[model samples]
Target: MGETNDVTALVAEVEEQERELVLTRFTHDDAWQLGCLLVELAVERRLAVTVDVRKGPQQVFHAALEGTTPDNDSWVQRKVRVVERFGASSFLTGLRARAKGQDFNAQHQLPLQEFAAHGGAFPVRVAGVGIVGVVTVSGLPQAEDHALVVEALRIHAAGGA
Candidate 1:
């Protein structure tokens, strides 16, 4: 059910943000590397960073440790409903708040203790179209995790459509 419109919008957004060299981060090949790096940082700082990626409502991906989860960890079916209801705006706002320390969810894994502790997540959209997926990272301070995910998304989005 991936809408062509949403995918297109996401592609456009990726292109626009790709130029923000400061935002680009790790690639698919570096997912584990990024996780390790985040974990190291979390160990140093003593914080947790648990996160997830949602496509509309369905959580397409998630990275967490044992016994940790999100505040709104709804079932995939319900997640789809959430996506349709909230659109990308609400989803991104929630993810950003988690990264910014505004809406801390202690239920999720902590950075140092978790494989990858602290990180960030963002709505993946095609500029002219709409949201297609979500990118999230964890294993360091929320700020650092966010920076990495932003950069990685920009870098990864560049070659994708």
Candidate 2:
């Protein structure tokens, strides 16, 4: 029961985040700023992670902090695919799948190597345009990866650095 309630609350929080973090507009400059901010935050916290921001298939910004490997980049790609395919945060997609007692891979029929439902990728939704791209981080625990992206998004959306 406690686990269920926790999942319910987390789902609500993520949903609210999705609604509230909508950008007025997303440009190349915006992606750069957001990606740099994520790097700054990770650096301040000494987090060794890789950050990526993309507008559609074009990557606007990407950085891999020290201690991250090529595997992190692969994770970012997989998680980004999840956001692109599901139109939601990868974490949220996984949570919803788990809540429904469904296997994400079995339900979605997406290859595990190409699409990961793990946290860290978030849709870059514009106020009028909907999801134009994704911001993703890798190299941390799943929830931590998701939280890092969310924190960066919250700061970016609020015009804070």
Candidate 3:
């Protein structure tokens, strides 16, 4: 790590760019699940979560994953933290912007919702219906974080929900 920038910001930016690149198109259903799964993966790993998908330049799609028995304060904070740090501009990309009428080919690609102290995110691609996005997971150890997202995607794909 040799540079003149805040490491966290740098990492976030990189993740944001990569995510934007993956989302080559946009689909309403796919966008919703992407955010939902991001939260699901976070809770699975006992981490808090919130996620959003953007279409075009300024459209924002957001969702929060809740914990059992009503509300999870920590999870709420996680959503708040992520939203505070990475908003639509920083996270949503041009692909999603351009995917308006096109058919997004990426199926149900997801992003790691957790931010790790070490940095690095799991980038998955959902290419099928003019929609694409990265499954970014962090907070937990690298492999563990990675697994959390991958597994979630698999489950969703299998369930067809």
Q: Of models 1 and 3, which has the larger TM-score? A: 1
* Predicted structure 2, TM vs. truth: 0.96
Q: Rank the candidates by TM-score, best first.
A: 2, 1, 3
Best by lDDT: 2
> How well does each candidate superpose onto the true structure, as a TM-score?
0.38, 0.96, 0.37
lDDT of 3 at 135: 41
| Residue-by-residue lDDT tens digits, candidate 2, 1-161 | 88778888888888998998898888999999999999999999999999999998899999999999999999999999899888999999988887777878889898889999999999999988899989999999999999999998888888885
Tens-place lDDT per residue, model 1, 1-161, is 34545545544453344334222333334344434444444445555545455544455445554343453232222323333444432234334334444542342322312222222444455555565554554444444655655654544545431
At residue 72, give the lDDT of candidate 3: 28
Candidate 3 lDDT, 61-161, residue by residue in tens: 45444533223223333333333344422122212322332221222232224321111223334455432333443344433444454455555555533
Colliding residue pairs in candidate 2: none
lDDT (Cα atoms) of all candidates against the true structure: 0.43, 0.92, 0.40
Off by over 4 Å in 1: 1-51, 65-119
